[model samples]
Target: MISSFSNNVYKMHQRTQIMRTTTFIKRRFSSAHITLKDSNYITREFEEISIPVPWGHLKGKWYGTRNVRPILGLHGWQDNAGSYDTLAPLLPNHLGFLSMDLPGHGHSSWLPLGISYHSIDYVSLLLRVMDYFQWDKISMICHSMSSINGFVFSALFPEKVDMMVGLDVLKPLARSSEKIVDNYKNCMNNIILHENRIISSEPPSYDWDELVDRLYYGSKKSVEREACKFLLKRAIRPSKDYPQKYYFARDSRLKTTYFYSFSKEVPIEMARYINCPYVFIKALQAPYYESRQHFDKTLDIMKQNPHFEYYEVEGTHHVHLNDPIKVAPIINSFIHKWRPS
Candidate 1:
């Protein structure tokens, strides 16, 4: 009986040792997993940077490690680099993102006093940026008006763009020749008026809440008030005239900037030239500026390409900014598939 009792005690002690060892192993692994996650979080943080341009400089918020070539991010009209703030965090940490504020829009330098901003000018801007970065090929994430610019850039220089992910806009709006002619005179006149006015005038000042309200409404309520802070990052400055008031920092001329529209034929031709992997996310609630037929025609051409992917998300025009959760997963998947090994 004494021998049997001793054996039982020995077996129990061995079982206890095994349990303790298993627990220690699990705890060590858990600690290691947490450390790795924290490291990834730290690496994904953004850094502010400026790229020198012949006109002046372009400001950008770079996310991820500096050594890697980043996907160029372009915001919508009048929006800034902060437009990608929410979405950037949701993207994979292994890849980098460089969200730029187009000239006259954010902290970037405005164009020369007499010059007019044109949609085509942005194509040249893209080229200049690529040249500055010494990137032989680039990937892009463009929103709204900038998405159209990307379309044009990729179409013109197919070899330069490796891939593109567009938010809410596909191509330049198709306009009737008659409407173009009628609007041209007004567009030119407004440019002159805005130039003369901005040369001598300061932007109107507003209280912080008022500025937020304006931004919220200016987007037709598509951008939530909470999201206004992102846009305000590059759009506002402390008022010199009034204490605690802020002024819009973007160039006023942007309001009257020249917009170039193409017909169905132009975009269709451009689509054929786009051979890179392209992902276009269309917001269901966003207005289709061009006629349905024109929009459909352009998509038809793009769909013919095997690499083209399309998604229709339920959101507003500024959906990417207001609700990045809905857009980030789709973009993440696309990026993962095409990202360089």
Candidate 2:
């Protein structure tokens, strides 16, 4: 029997799933949409670094310039490096950015054949990304699900990051046993009932205009059409038969049932234990999954965390990447304050 709250949650979840799938199927590819300019100040370079996973090589790009200060940018789930393309321009000059597509998303190869994408695996991947760049310590800016990983990384390896900024999500700690069971049941229900299929038997070709519409109006709200095109290019690939088809390389099984309950005693304390300066930019309009009581308790842990500070932004989940004006300065200010003289 579905409780009223569970029923409401499932309805919202279904709507989101449908919209995402429709957007994924209809997304297009166009070179005219690539917005990164060949300017004097910004020098972009694409490079391939072996992630040393059992699967194979994972390609990443080093954006900005070689000599500039280094900052690592991690994108959200099912999103790629281009998530930063628009926001990167708004950042303060003189700092280099490294944006990498996580293993199962974007240009990077999958994790072998049978290996499923798990939340825990990202910790090791971040360390590998840091090691590949030869940066013993650096600053980080992350969005959505990636933000959770960033928080965990910061808590576990506080010394590695000089300062860290997380957008729209804090690292969620353990939940009550009932809540945990409910979440697990939902996941299992989804995996069993939902068939993970994006493209149709004959996928339709999409022009630039149609692609932008699906992205801007469909998933993201009030995003400029032109900016939407730029994101589409990174999100999609060219189809030979049709106009151009966009198919996400991210694993569909990521949506399947899974358990992520952690030890509340230690990890929440770990966030409190983070040694470096930390900033959390939360989305004001976002929904808190757990109840207000539990949510308040969790944030109380954050408030007590000495090295942490948080700011609320004016958007939905993907606040930072979607809106440059609100997020860019907050990131810049945090980094500027922490950067060495």
Candidate 3:
């Protein structure tokens, strides 16, 4: 039955979210604007696509038309492109939105055996994507873990990215020296363990409802029952050994991804290089993954950029998924101001 306090929390959000969603629907057209193309290629209209990488292909969903350069949408850790299912359609149709399954997530091919997924490699992957599209500049729209990636990428390649929008994160949390050492040790050990499982183990299968329950509790009730379906759509596949059962499609080794964190001073320096039009939305109810002191100091540096905009909204970590109404307006307005056609 998967009953727990977390499930109770999910029930609470569900009760509240229905009202919030209805309000959004009532004003959807006015908020989205009539200027949006009549035949917008978003959400249900999205095209399934794949981008070639060295090892294999990175699969994705392309929202909107192919003619114009699109914003690159990156999701959180362990989440696939479906993380944007609710938010993508709310975006203005002036440009496309390409939500790619980062390596090892969703339908994307996992990295070759033994090559641990590193944070910097995703930056390289973004560059490869740019090269494939032959675009001179990029506009990034990211959430959770990828928010940190966007921050680092914008800071490192200031001139290459035209704009960036991050949801609920600024950068990787600063770790204590001891924490860092322990994490490194644990990361290596986990990597070896997962590698062994990949070769010698068959993943356990769950029924569809059970899959939903796992996602609901797995996200600590941040993703409610209704919202779990979006992520699960891309996260699971039919099991070969079990009739009418499924297994998670993502790479198990991804649970041990080596996050590239820095000392406080480095992120401050990095923040200064981000000169593009940037928007960062903080979920007030979300945990501050790092020291607020570290976040505040780094944020102070970023605020110096003339184009930076920041706001906080009431919701949990997956607010963009669970209650997109609160965030869609900010994103639409930002896009209108910064990326006007």
Candidate 4:
């Protein structure tokens, strides 16, 4: 009887060990399957698309399906579509994003030989993009200069903008009448110089590390080193002469951007016209180029609108790129609330 009992106990122990091994194997396979599925899902999310213009085609990355209208993303001055690279992935996948390179930026065509880059010109670009996509109304996610553009656009065509999310900017810098006249003269001279450069000069090429360093410091170190790869996606191209070297693909003439800025009164008046859902996020560390009073005045006007919302986050001008996690949640929440089902 004792021998039979010992033998049964051994068999039970063996069965328990076998069950433990099987459970471990199942868990391992389940984890691997999840990782593979996520990788595949990411790969299938974004589609490359282009819109043809009079000069050339505007390149874009469409994140999500074409069946639904997308939230239009516009980058800051001199930045490209890749500006959204980090932030886009963090947002809800149910909504679509159409991040495009503005004229003279990224793979998009440059303006004609003598045509200068101006704030108003971007508004026209916005209109052209809408027309090309056959979108009766637009929803925008914009940063810096592009944010200002969205402000102008929404103010001018209140009914056309369904909703807008602006990051790190509220309005264009206001200047005295004297400064405006001076700026016009400076703008003309710079435009002429940039035009000549565009015709006669090729952008300087650099090694990969050097290119990343330049971009990092060029943004005053707002962009982190590791994050440089995101901007480099659309910003660099192989040099024609040196296979190993790369040049900035964006038009160098963009450096001489002209701003047909509005006075404080103008933006205030414009703010009155904006009645749609709007969100403005100010980076705490970013310089308020316009006076605090001016910023406050604009905010007050926007506050009167029932749908307007304002937020502040801790970061630099390129906060959306450097620390997307901090910005993405607020943006995603706003979009999720206002975006159409």
Candidate 5:
């Protein structure tokens, strides 16, 4: 918000935690042991998985032993599951890690036409995933857009969440009524335009260097140049029309997401409902997207929870992926205290 394929060999493209007590429910999960990045623990394995939904299916990457209830990982808007590539391995052994591309974001199928993507829809989608796994209580690791989803989900159903860790974002952003109205209008217009383009046009394809450049600069250089490869793994597909060029496979409609901006009072009120063991890491350089007062107010309310931990780290919005070593220790601390394996 994030793969292994190199630009030199572009042919191959590829591809959480929790407090819910010691309930060990195992599914028929396929397990593989592969060495992850510079992980602090011994080798942790990963496998590619596809979870069925009514429309189509959602694809994901599962790391470590799948027999244990894994901490579900959610990436930022536009990013795929590979966003956790570096950070997953750094987690505690036996804790397990699972991350999936939200529909229209990675290998997951896009919503059928006529359904516009809303940030709040993810709350229901999270429920679908939980039912799929038949999980009783869940732990989460969310970044950016998904982080806000976690905030809303936790507020809506506080008892279902055992623990949560949000990176760089905490709630649905606040905006003036006029600004929200303008954005809503723009989103409606853009949805129709994006739909027409998708039905009638082929997306522009880019060379490998250009893809990396776009990802690096497009995120305002938040994702390091080298770190760009992890996201590119599941992001690009070799173009059928043009050799040596690739196109982004995700649904373009995600770019114009219709976030239902709430007033600051709503999120502050929502914060009071989150009683789970929570950790929020704020990247100092990231934009607030609104007034700092709005963020501070919500945070102050969340701080009232004794189990809630907050840290301000020096990095960009994608700090979890860019410099995971700095982020992992904070997470590890929360895990050992709340839901140790």
Candidate 6:
């Protein structure tokens, strides 16, 4: 009799679980757009468009409008358009901005099924975007890795980008010879694994709280708690099998070294050649890396470049995102002066 009662309880529990999962899925899919409001910023959902890339199609978000002044925005590695959640709203609304999720990040499609991601390829993608828009000139606001891309693009296509504001990491100069070999080896391994369909599966289901906590503690160490919540919208979704469970949409392989490794003479060379009106906001509190001399050498290039401007912002690497006051005015004034007369 007891055995039969226990079996009945187990079945009942399974049914309850199914009902919960169904409810969660309904809720998850129901709200696709979120309106964001803050002291000086108002944000609403933007449309997504797909553009063809060599490896595959890339998805991008259009913020503001085509009629507004044009500014192309780019986010950092592993970060999405959401990276600009705080700053985008602060920008002059009269200007239209296109903030894209580089391949392997955010809503942008990953490289064609078998291919791995490379930092250099993003520069080419930016060019394709310019061609798609038929934009003769673009103003740019880029953070971290994308900042490097912005500088490189500006250098290669000087007329294409009129002015730009780069937040931290203006250039990654002086990589050790050993590091270069290792990175190439790792990228090769990733390419092989990716082609072989050996990429890791999606992250396991987690609670919303746990997801936010991980992002805060891990990648977004400098982000404000309230601001961090905004990123959660893009990072999570209800699981089909569990009612209260949420899962990450990003590829699990994102954390692998195979996908991310520094190569020699990249952004450094890219930065030195930039000739457009550019401002570099260097973080004062954060150390460049294990080595400071190498970072100084890159800074020296910025020093020598006449068109390049540098500012020492008081915060960590991502400080501008959390405290816009430090970076917003710089962006605002630069745009005001550079906007076509």
Q: Which ranges of candidate 3 are over 4 A from the true structure?
A: 1-43
Enumerate residue pairs that collide in model 5.
3-230, 16-71, 16-97, 17-71
lDDT of each: 0.77, 0.61, 0.80, 0.77, 0.81, 0.62
Question: Which digits, one per residue and each the tens of the lDDT, describe model 1 over residues 1-341?
Answer: 22243233111110011111111101221111111111222123677799998889999988887777889899999999878766776678777899999999889999998888888998899888888888898899999999999888879998888889988889988888887776677778788888877777677899877987999899998777766776776788777888877888998888876787666588889988988899998988898888888888888899888888888876788877766656766787788999854
Native-to-model Cα distance after best TM-score fit, residue 24 in candidate 2, in Å: 34
Best by lDDT: 5
lDDT of 2 by residue, 132-211 (tens): 66778868888877788888888888888888888776775467778778876776666533343432332344555565
Q: Candidate 5 — what's its lDDT? A: 0.81
Query: What TM-score should be assigned to candidate 1?
Result: 0.86
Whose lDDT is higher: candidate 4's or candidate 5's?
A: 5
Sort all candidates by lDDT, best to worst. 5, 3, 1, 4, 6, 2
For 1-341, candidate 5 gives per-residue lDDT tens digits of 21235432122221121111211111122222222233223234678899999889999989878788999999999999989877786788768888899999879999987889998998899899999999988899999999999999999998999889999997888888898889899998899888999998678999878998999999999897767877888888878788878898899999888886787678988999999889898888899877888998999899899888888766789978766655776787788887877
- Candidate 2 stretches with Cα past 4 Å from truth are 1-53, 173-226, 240-243, 257-259, 263-267
Relative to the true structure, candidate 3 has a C-alpha RMSD (angstroms) of 6.8
How well does each candidate superpose onto the true structure, as a TM-score? 0.86, 0.73, 0.88, 0.85, 0.88, 0.78
Query: What would the per-residue lDDT of candidate 3 be over residues 50-72, giving only the tens digit for each residue?
Result: 98989999999898879989998
Distance from true location, Cα of 143 in model 6, Å: 0.9
lDDT string, candidate 6, 1-341, tens digits? 22243233111110011111111101221111211223333444466667777666676667666675468778876667767656665667667767777777776666555555666677777767778777767788888878867766776777667888888776544567787677777666665564454344434777756766777777647655545554555555567777777776655445442322445456566556677788878777665653776666666776676766677766667765565545666677677777743
lDDT of 1: 0.77
- The TM-score of predicted model 4 comes to 0.85
Candidate that beats the other on lDDT, 1 or 6, i.e. the better one: 1
115, model 6: CA deviation in Å? 0.6
